[model samples]
Target: MPARERNHPLRLLTGALASSRPWTFLRSSQIGHRIRHSLSAKLAVAITLAALVLLLVFGIIVASQLRSSMFETRKDAILADASLRFSSAQSVFSSSTATSPDQVQESARGALASLKASAAGAGATNVALLRSEGSTASLRINQIEDEQMRGLITPQMREAVAQGGAQWQSVGIRASDSDKVSPGILVGTQVQLPRAGTHELYILYSLAADQRQVDVVLRVLVLSALPIIVTLPIGVFALLHRLLLPVRLTVSAATKAAEGDLDVRVEVHGADEMAALGRAFNAMTSSLQDTISRYDELAKLQQRFVSDVSHELRTPLTTIRMAEDIVWDNREDLPAHARRSAELLHDQTERMEQMLADLLEISRYDAASALLDAEERDLRPIVTRVVEACAELAQRQGVPVEVVAPARAAAEIDERRIERVIRNLVVNAIEHADGTRVTITVATSATDVACRVRDRGVGMTQEVADHVFDRFYRADTARARTTGGTGLGLAIATEDVAIHGGRLQAYGEPGKGASFLMTLPKHAGDEIASWPLALWEDE
Candidate 1:
């Protein structure tokens, strides 16, 4: 087989998979499809994102303000305490009587001890005093012991103190170079003593207590914000789903009614608009059912009348045909013009007889009263008999009847009905051949048989082929109705083939030719699985 013909479905599948559109990804992935299209998922995502952003913004603002306020309060109290102790000790240094460096150091130590005693429970951890003598700096007082901690003084703070104001810096608490650390602040000031000259006074304030208080505030903020953010979307989804339940039910009921179950109805609840819609649907279906019932009754009555009238006319028509035959036989002894009239009268009467027979046959089909009588037989003899019967008509039309079959083809069939079906097709093909040759071909399969009739003139169009099986329909309605074709030969032939569980099909093209195919099961109980011959002779 060619690649295009063998892999057509695979090519189509590959094309679908190679799409780059967003919907392709969403619809192809099971979880992504749900997440992309589900209203609940969209709602949850939107709510969670908005809530988190707001909470984070508020949390940052509060944390920043609370930390700033806490540090400012600690700085104020630390500077106040340092200022008061330095002012009190300034008097002791100013009243000193010694003028030597050793005496100045001893006086400074005495003043520092006095300040430390006066500042008990004031939250200051330690104090340092450094004096500048000429170009060298001397530590006159030192309460903290780490060498690195003694160097914590910055030049900016010293400059601020020298300009006659106090200065402070946030500092970490470290007692030794390798010791544990804690939080604190440093406040320093410049003080002038009588013998020691200008000196720097520093105070360290511990901030561990303030840090613990801020931690408690943060914990409370988290506890208050998390629950509202998480449960809000779930609550909204549950409420919306409950509100849409009735809409889903109404859609389901409408789907069933559209699929041909007119009895389906929706349940009404309360005096809402949905209830009114359900009531209106029920009323429409009830009215429609009543109208359909009336149509069915009228159709059955029409079929009954046709059957009765056909039967009633059969006896009277037989009597008239007998009387006409007697006159037709004596027409040779009459005048020329009278004999010609007799011939036309006889032909018209025969055409009426054929029409009545076709009407009775169609009535039996509409009433579904026809049955098949099957027996095992050879088709060669039956074919020979039909061909011999149609020889006169074929000769009159100047169209040769050609047959192609094996010497012996056997099958189980209703002989009389099958012969009638084949005879109708042969006669129809002869009438349309227009002096061209007609061919009848019979072929046998393991479980089925097929007969084909082909004419080389007056082919059919698509519109005519589609509705050719309708009763009383003619392909060429504008043609003169001169021939005795009652327009019912092929109609009865189709119903007769249907009675024996066979198919009758017609195929044609406008200017080429036409073909009629009849396929049947070989045995009475065997199903027709496939045809033995091709649909078109070109194959």
Candidate 2:
């Protein structure tokens, strides 16, 4: 396969590794989210990153100090060796027996050869003898052993050598045979010959050994650091997992407790802070469980008392209703004041009986005994009947009610409860409508049906709208109970709809109007996906 199109596993892996960055991975949303949510991941990443930074800084400092110290020590050794060689070479030229240029050249060549041979054992790479500039002698000798070594000694080194003491410079030593260059030091000094005048002697020493040593130390540091950097996250993650085990258990216990498992408790082992937290959590749940138990008992007692009272009052109410009917029938034969009093008494007695019936129904709901006797039935008849039943109130309040429903609006619902719910909605609308027309819009979809009772009346504010369905919550507290409302109509309607797996919502804007929308599944046991009618009517 062609290399570019090979798709080799190792190539793919290397490409990914080369392109990936630690910060990029850390900043990724998935990883960031996990780290933010998970205590273990957060601690692991933090500790590992800190270790990596400390290791890198420590390694850089050690390598820099080690390389600098090695170079300085090698420079000193080069200077000392070159000085000893310079002394020996100078002595050889001073005792030379040369008279002509040819003889001086020969002596210079011999001294250079000897110096090269002696310094070769001390890591010297090249040596040179050059006549000083402006030298006036009968014979002047300028000899360089290697051409490449000439340029290695800078002009600055030459000038420093001319001032009378030994001078050295760090440089690169190019090989005589190849282009390879190694780190080196050049030491130069002035020398005098028998026939030749002043001359400069230079020695170049290769630092390849010292360079190799430093390279070795660097490789060791990098290799050791690689394992440490790779293992830090894994080790920290494992340690965090072990350390956070108690927290995990506590979280699990808390979740179960939130899900109504009041008996759930964290398992405590060691006498640590985590153990203390577990103890505190267990105590809180126990107290909450006890408090809920007491509340449940009180609620049960209240329901039973209400249920018993409602049952007990039915007998007396039935007796009073019989006597009230007889008096009402005979009111036309009595005085005008007596007849008015009889009418008022009859109205009050009827209101009390209705309130008692509502209380019994509420008791059933509170005790969780409410049942739905659902049947597939057309809802238009129910809506029409509710409108007809509340026709008197709507007429009395001067609020005209309009029912806009399809001829065949059908749903699975208990006829009695649904009728009661519709009745309550109609009555409530007429009462609060402020003499404006009340509209009952019934719409249906494939899965759900809805009814909206919209009234252009004295609209409630948002706060009133929110709690309009709460039992005994009157928006106008000082208003007389002229409508004979028990104040549980909306609340009972809400419960009725909820029992059928439906929803009832209220929408209102002060001074505009109020709307109550009831949505239900068309088929029994089906979920309501969407409403057929909008909650707010379009202006």
The candidate maximizing lDDT is 2
Model 2 per-residue lDDT tens digits across residues 1-539:
00011111111111222333444343778878988999999999899889877976786677667766776677667777888899999999899988888888888888888998899877887788877777887665556656677676667667777777787766776666898556777778889988678999988788777766766676777767778888889999999989899999999999999999999988888899989999999999999999999999998898899999999999999999999999999999989999999999898998999899899888889989988899998889999888988888888889999989865768999989888988887888888888898999998888898899999888889999889999989999886554787788888898999988899999988777899899999876677988899989756
lDDT of 2 at 46: 92
RMSD of 1: 15.4
Q: For each candidate, how many residue pairs have backbone atoms clashing (under 3 Å)?
A: 0, 0
The Cα error of candidate 2 at residue 137, in Å, is: 9.8
- Could you tell me the lDDT of residue 477 within candidate 2? 86
Each candidate's TM vs. the true structure? 0.57, 0.81
Candidate 2: give the clashing pairs: none
How far does residue 92 in candidate 2 sit from its true spot (Å)? 5.8
Which 10 consecutive residues of model 2 have the lowest summed lDDT? 1-10
Off-target runs (Cα >4 Å) in candidate 2 are: 1-38, 85-116, 127-182, 186-202, 218-239, 406-408
Candidate 1 lDDT by residue in tens digits, 54-91: 87777768877777777667666766787787777777
